[model samples]
Target: MTSKFYEDTKVIVKDKLFEHGWGILKDLYLGETPLASIAQKSFETATGTKLATVYLLDLFKENIVAIHGEYQSQATNVLSTCNVFIKENSTANEVSNCVDDFLKNANHYIDESFSRRLFLKYGY
Candidate 1:
């Protein structure tokens, strides 16, 4: 998939899994979780194509499992930045812009990581 499409699919799958409380399960452990099924369905729905189960699982691992910690770190950084802006009495617009920029960067990071992992694993 193209980077843009993969990134969009990641957002959809992430939202769907989170809606089903996948984050809590992820924090606990891994292996045959229902989130995999949810992720597969979400991907098919978003992309109009059904990938093999193994491929789907790999995609899930790359998109969610592998990057969970980094995602959390980015989230923390954005929150800290917002807090700093608040403490400095920065304008609301400044805080909003910071958050927007962080989100854009975070999405780029996810896309880049996903592409890198796929290339390393499959040599695409």
Candidate 2:
């Protein structure tokens, strides 16, 4: 059985990321323990914002990952939104940089992870 999130959401490709455009990016789990650890660290070291959403995409083929979140602090009444898109082959450092860049440029915020799930399960 494939994970619920994978079954429902389409894989995020480079074209889709381009379609979303760029903005400020503000951006886990167990037994998941090691995978979750890498994922959590990837986001934690990359951006200065709270992680609000996560998505694992391009499964089997590329294992692409994307995230959406907001900056940790804001003085205004409105909060800035951030989006990050990582290629399937990105290294740990690259993942961090990709996220950091996204948050720095994000301007608006919207809900994109309605179908996203925190757990990942795969079985034969």
Candidate 3:
């Protein structure tokens, strides 16, 4: 991904994940992400070949996975992929803290640019 889009994705992911109980998305580069293929196929089925071609070829490069894997280690995946159960009685602040903790832990695995973007966006 380009630096600009990466920054934008970071902002959107942080904000939406903070507000919603479930807003995690699978990037096109990750092989282990279960949603990646499904999301790709879904887009293809809905929009024909146009979107998937751009997504798979132009937008995200498959060759980046080897380098991406080095940064996105197993511990990072575990910390970021936690399944939090938000109770009906839970306050918004409580939920925010949980998400913030997840994001803070996730900082270790991402690139410095993306990490800086998240820190600026979330102010922590």
- Per-candidate local distance difference test: 0.32, 0.34, 0.32
TM-score of each: 0.28, 0.30, 0.27
Over 1-124, each residue of candidate 1 has an lDDT whose tens digit, in order, gives: 2233233433444554355334422311155332322222111212132221111122332332112212222223212222111112334454345334434554444334443345445665
TM-score-based ranking: 2, 1, 3
Candidate 3 or 2, higher TM-score:
2
Reference-based TM-score, model 1: 0.28
Model 3 TM-score relative to the real fold:
0.27
Scored against the true structure, residue 108 in model 3 reaches a CA lDDT of: 36
Q: List residue ranges in candidate 2 displaced over 4 A.
A: 1-62, 70-81, 106-124
Clashing pairs in 1: none
lDDT by residue (7-106, candidate 2, tens digit) is 2232222223334443212222333321211121111212222343233332434454555433232332112334455655565566556645653453
**Model 3 spans with C-alpha error above 4 angstroms:** 1-83, 109-124
The parts of candidate 1 lying over 4 Å away from their true place are 1-69, 72-87, 115-124
